[model samples]
Target chain A: MNSVLPNRAWTFISLLIAMVFLTLQNNSSAAQFLPNWPWLVMMFWVLTTPHKVNIGSAFIVGLLCDSLLAQPIGLFALLFSLSAYFMTTLSAHYKGLPIIQQSLYIGLFYGLFQLCLDVFSYASKPENSLELNLWPVGLVFVFWGAVQYSLERLSRPAPIE
Target chain B: MFNYGIHERIRIKTALASVSAVLLLILDLHFGMMNQARTYLYSITSPIQMVSAQISLQSKNLHQWLLNQEAQEETQAQLESENRMLKAQLLQFNHLKRENKELRALLSVSPSQFATRYRLAQIISIAQGSGQQVTQINKGSQHSIHAGDAVVDTQGLIGQIQHTSLLNSQVILITDPNQMIPVINQRTGLRGVVQGNIKNLKLRFIPQGSDIKTGDVLLTSGLGQHFPEGYPVATVDHITQHNNSEFLTVYAQPIAQLHQSSYVLILEQGAQ
Candidate 1:
């Protein structure tokens, strides 16, 4: 139990640092190629440790993301918390899934996430003529492949199982 | 503790959190009561953002340092010539400024007539999300930055301050979907409204036979009193007219370096 506390704390801190770093990269005009990394990080944590990353934690992180991005307050919070809940319910079966299947799950989840953001954005501001970008949905699969490979190489224990 | 049941507790908590999130969403959409909360959160994140920005700036400087010596020498020579030209122009510009100030005083249009005060702000972060075109700056209410204050780069009008926190603020760029600036055609002197989106600005309500042409410059008309007068906004890019329509579709590209630049002047309006 003592060892678990320190490990959990370190993991939480590392995740926060990663989120902040990703947020900074996202905001920089120099890096327009980076995707929604915070979302990926959140999803990774949720899949790996549902017991540790609760809905409240997701909500807070989402709110922080919204603030950093200058988006409508609570918009990301709502989306992220809902995603956390969905991931928590599916984590049991998800942990046992093969790498290919896991990548598909991430693609599906991220696709839905981007779709919701696009739809909400369009509805909120009709003048932008913002289209539901299927390209980002496609890109999520590619990103998941890279993210999963990196996570597998980095983690001491198997993250998926 | 009593057996509250872990699974039941998880289900109940998730439901509660989701409901609260929905409530927050409604509050944010309808009333915007959450802006204060957002401001506080932004303040908490400001330190990390500032450090990151500094790191990025340093890295960019290092990249420039690593460039070939010939390129560096060329840049230095160009800068020196530009500096000399600016110095020569500054003398004449100062004389003209003094004469203009005296004339304005004679006309009873002194500093009281408009915002002479401005605050220099550094762009901290831009909204990487889709839809809105907001940029965060280092100045905030502590620096007297208020909402609706006009922001401008060296080239032209950038946008208006949309929200203010203690040490930071959000600026809605002129290209944001919700932005509307009253602009006048520099060539024809015809007043029209310029609306913006992610793509480009559209000059709306233009008469079919309006003299606005491609490449015509547009400046803020200061009709709404939000932005100061005579700031360059955009240049007319394309014009389209349908046979049956009474209006022409005129698209303009913003003159402000909205994405590339990282600093701006926040115009603070004074008592008129």
Candidate 2:
């Protein structure tokens, strides 16, 4: 129990730091490659420790991201929270799946998130034309690969099992 | 503790998280109170930003220095030959002063304007977000820069100051969707409102039969009182005629390099 607390604390701090760095990089320029990092972090946390980092924490982090990045305030929060919840509920069934399969699934999840963000932004501001560049979506697969490799290396004894 | 259940603990935690998220969203949306707090917090973190910017600047400078050294080495022999040739050419050109003066007067000229009070400012930081594209300059209220003061660079009008802190001010660029400038065609004197489009500015409310044409210069009419009179805003790049509408759609490329430049001049209020 004592050991578990420190690990949880470290994970939380790492997630927070990732969120801040993502916000900074995303807000600086329109053409950036680093914004997808937070989604990877969120996905990794959800897959590894659902109980320790719940949907609520995801939502809060998403809200801060939205605020700092100046997207629709509640949009990212709501979507991220829902994504975490879905992952947590489905993690058990998918846990036995191969890493590449899991990464493809995560990439699809990120693509859907991007699609929703586009739809919401368009609906809110009709004047701004939607430029859907597939580059960011493609970049997510790279992040997914990294997440898969890192998670495997950092795997620990499953508390719930 | 005797009656506590696992489900109860989960519910309580979930509820607490939900409430907090809602509260944060409300604070972010309703009043922009959190934005103010964030700005204050950003000021505290600005030293870090400054250091990072300096590192990037130094790297760029180093690259430029290396390029200059290479160019000097490559040009050393050629420049020496060219210098002797240019000296001879200069002696020949010195006798053609009367011809040069006649040609200059025939060309189109920038109009003369009265001297105005100007405040030199360095861009401290650019707003880091999608919603508002603004730049913060080092000079602010302490420098007598009030809201609505026009900011310009050497080329032309850049923007107007929207908000001011003690040591910083936010300048909303002319390319921003929300910014509008009152302008007139310098050649035809046709007046129209130059509104910022997403990427460029468009002149709205110009009548279909207006004398405006491509390559005509647009100057601030000073009707808005926000910007000074006769500063170049943009050049008419294209004019489209609409069959059904009374107004002609005019698109002008902004003269100021709003994205690339780092320095600007904030015109002192009442100077114009």
Candidate 3:
């Protein structure tokens, strides 16, 4: 029974979801250099188990993150919902791509995500000019392999009894 | 809706969530319709944020200590004393000014007002990579703190309380473009507006050859009534003028350790 809980996709995925709060809460001055860990974890699960973890859950989790990070209530919710939509639509072809191409694909969307964040930041006060820093997207590509590998191992199904 | 395929169901759900999120964002931004809800949510999450800030600060100090034990110890001492030294200097200035006022009063001259009220609060966490240049504090409306109160450190003025929740508040620092302070040249009593350009504070509209010069001191003019009078705000660090410009470009470094100070004083509105 203990082993079964680890193999249950929903259980493991929820645990990953819980870590999102901790990751965002612990953000420090160097947080700008760090990739958005919660987003990457959400993408992995939404891509793999779209049925169990749907857009609604993504939106709710994003709201919690917004609360924790002291951002506007729905800024991240909007982004997460849009990301879930795109990922759910692309999950079919995403798994077939080679590692390099997969990372590049992730990078493409990650760049888009960073752009949205920057735009929202400017919209904080329209008087402030927009600033675009997409270097952290590179960190997403760097972390892509490790995040994907570990999550896959954690949620791997148990062997036949 | 019930007859839709699985993919179609997911797409519909996504559309609903996106639309809902946009609506929430609009209401929250334009009307602050969600402040009550947001505050309640913050009540639950703020403790976690506080814990994270504590851990990060402790880890940073530990890292510095391990990496350079002697140097870190020296730097810690210097930081601790820096606030005390600035406070002492301001106190001496105030004492002399008060004595001068007393002497003038003896001759039937006008007397000026001075300030003494300040409430202390500890730093919680600073907003990261945001252009707003705001920092959250541990005290809030529950502690009699309210919006628009002028916040200062041991050294000088930092910013004003932009807003307050029941448990936390954010201070908009002097270094944000949106903030402007009225400052007087302590040496010559010349007045100018100090505005922030992201990284530096610029004292604006000083006409060419005004009595201002490099290393001159600037203090609050108390013209706006938002900030307390006579607090050391900044020191003139640089002055430049274009060959044909009508005004001299004056830049001053802020006296308050805006990012470094752990505790801050908020001048209460009613007290003033």
Which pairs in model 2 have colliding backbones?
A: none
TM of each candidate vs. truth: 0.81, 0.66, 0.72
lDDT of candidate 1 over B1-272, digit per residue (tens): 75777677777877887788778878877886886786688777776666666776787789998999999999999999999999999799778767877888899984323455879999877875653688878888899999889999989999999878777788999988679999888888999999986768999999888888899999998788878888899999999999998999999999999988888999996423
DockQ of 1: 0.50
- Number of colliding residue pairs in model 3: 0
**Cα shift from native, residue A159, model 2 (Å):** 18
lDDT of each: 0.79, 0.70, 0.78
lDDT of 3 by residue, B166-266 (tens): 77777888987778999999999899999975567999999987888888989999887888778888999899988898999888899999878988998
Model 2 lDDT tens row, A42-160:
77877877777767777766765554444535656777776776687767777888877887788788778877767765664588687554566777766677765664444443465
True contacts kept of 1: 0.53
**Cα lDDT for residue B272, model 2?**
31
Docking class for model 2 is incorrect
Q: Which of the two, 2 or 3, has more TM-score?
A: 3
Instruction: Rank by TM-score, highest first.
Output: 1, 3, 2
Clash number by candidate, in order: 0, 0, 0
Instruction: List runs of model 1 lying over 4 Å from the truth.
Output: A1-5, A28-35, A125-161, B1-5, B30-34, B104-121, B139-147, B164-168, B205-211, B239-249, B268-272
Per-residue error for B191 in candidate 1, Å, reads: 3.1
